[model samples]
Target: MTDSRFSCVLFDLDGTLVDTAPDLTGALNHVLSQHNLAPFSVQKVRNTVGFGARITIERSFAHYGKTLSEDALDLAHAQFLAHYSENICKNSTLFPGVDTVLEDFKSNGIRMSVCTNKTENLSLDLLEQIGVSHYFSSICGSDTVPNKKPHPDHIFSAINRAGGITEESILIGDSMADVESARAAGIPVIVMRYGYTAIPSDELGADLVLDAFSQIPQALRDLSH
Candidate 1:
């Protein structure tokens, strides 16, 4: 592969590009507290994340040894969304060296985009709040396409939205969802070991395992080769 093999870098939002677990778990705990349920720890919720808010809130309820009925789940989800939307990015921060790495990508003229399971408006709001929204040419959230991650459509759509061809794009992500989607879409993928992946990052079988954002340029080069 040559440098021309990749012209875009698609990223996973929550755990990969930013440490959103603080606000994400906080909102879940807020909803749980409303029902007099014990709150979930940030670490606990971090492990349950990557699947999206409905699932995160669902798992939080389960962690308290209680399951919600369909109607109850719906109501709880609404409450969680409301609270999360209001407090999005309150404590979230970009991972170490992300800004500098992104600047490097921009200087190299590599297009960048986001493909996340978070809903579109919420994802955009969070990115905007964190002041990195300008970095992504496209932000394809769960609702932005017909299907979400672990499905190839999400990856393809993100690349397309960024005006990059599939063969000329790679993904930097943190979960099996990212790996599976990237693989399915024939996109080379690099995983961040420090992000909120459910399984071991190495075990995810990404083209590269990046322990820090600082390793990104090298990993992208290796993947291109």
Candidate 2:
């Protein structure tokens, strides 16, 4: 295996590391059902992700041409979370090549962390349920940091919490939020072409654009040069 260029690698949990849209869409549909609204398909819901559960709830509701009041949104958010937590891992799986890539990093003495917009406890629960929690030295979420992604603090906090230095750190993610955050934080970022995003992954302007997780080690090697 090729050596990694970074001392620390921070991954965005949902799209970058795991394919979580199935369960997330299931949770969203459960909430919509309670309100007698139409449910969204997994493909449609994929682009709505990356912000957080509350935003997901909002976007799903808007899809039905319904605007939710703050109180209604709060209720829907609570309902979505309850249903989601119960079935968080029912269909979630690590992306192809994730395990091998993680193993390579581990064996190479590179530190790793999960930096996600999901809530802290939920991110922890999902990571554990998906059986990859042990690979990460730190798992930071939107709620765990002072600010969420698109704000550099989310990246900084995740790296710092993992005892990683900014100079030797890199981010792997699938969204514009990740690009903006890493750029603002002054670090290189790699984006996955197969991840969930409203914008095209290649158009996201990352340092590297990968078609599969297996491409990561080679990409890291290229970046190091």
Candidate 3:
């Protein structure tokens, strides 16, 4: 295999690499049902993802025209986390072509890592259950760094953990957080068209906006030139 132009490839976990909305929605609905609230469909929940479970829980509460006190919110978050951890991969699956793309990256000698807004332990659990944990040299989450995405420290932490340098790294993600984080870190970012975001991918102002997971390696090759 030939060496790749990029030494390190950083990915955002939830929307970029995996279609986790189904299981996320399942856990969310479980929490909502506990409070006797109506459940949101997976399609509806997709827009609420990317920020992490707490935010998703908060959004769900807001949707029901209710507000939670700090302590209540914390308890709800705990419930969501516990349930999600147990059912992490119940319906979660990698996006089409993810395994192939990851294999291509590995064969080309590129180091890879995951940087996500999900909690560290949960992220690890999900990745492990999804069967792609072996591909990432490092997998960092919201609790892994002092600051989460939109803050450069998260990206830096992931790169450092993966033994990667910023100058030779690039980010592939599907949200404003990813775009902003990569920009703050002074790295190129690619946004996937189909991801869990309210805003369109093209509107996120990424270096490249791709429509399919299969297009990533070629997109990176194009960026390298």
The best candidate in terms of TM-score: 2
Better of 1 and 2 by TM-score: 2
Ranking by lDDT: 2, 3, 1
Summarize candidate 3's per-residue lDDT along 125-194 as a digit string, tens digits: 8888888888999998999998999899999999999999889999999999999999999999999988
- Flag the better candidate by lDDT, 1 or 2: 2
lDDT of 2 at 174: 96
* Local distance difference test scores for all models: 0.88, 0.91, 0.90
lDDT of 2 by residue, 39-116 (tens): 889998789998888988887787778899999999999999999999999999999999998988898888899999
Best by lDDT: 2
Question: Can you write out model 1's per-residue Cα lDDT over 49-105, one digit (the tens) per residue?
Answer: 887888877777776688999999999989999999999988999999998988888
In model 2, state the lDDT of residue 33. 95
Where model 1 places Cα greater than 4 Å from the true spot, the runs are 1-4
Clashing pairs in 2: none
lDDT minimum window of 10 residues, candidate 2: 1-10
Q: What ranking of all candidate models by TM-score puts the best one first?
A: 2, 3, 1
| Candidates 2 and 3 compared by lDDT, better number | 2
TM-score of 3: 0.96
- Candidates' RMSD to native: 1.7, 1.1, 1.3
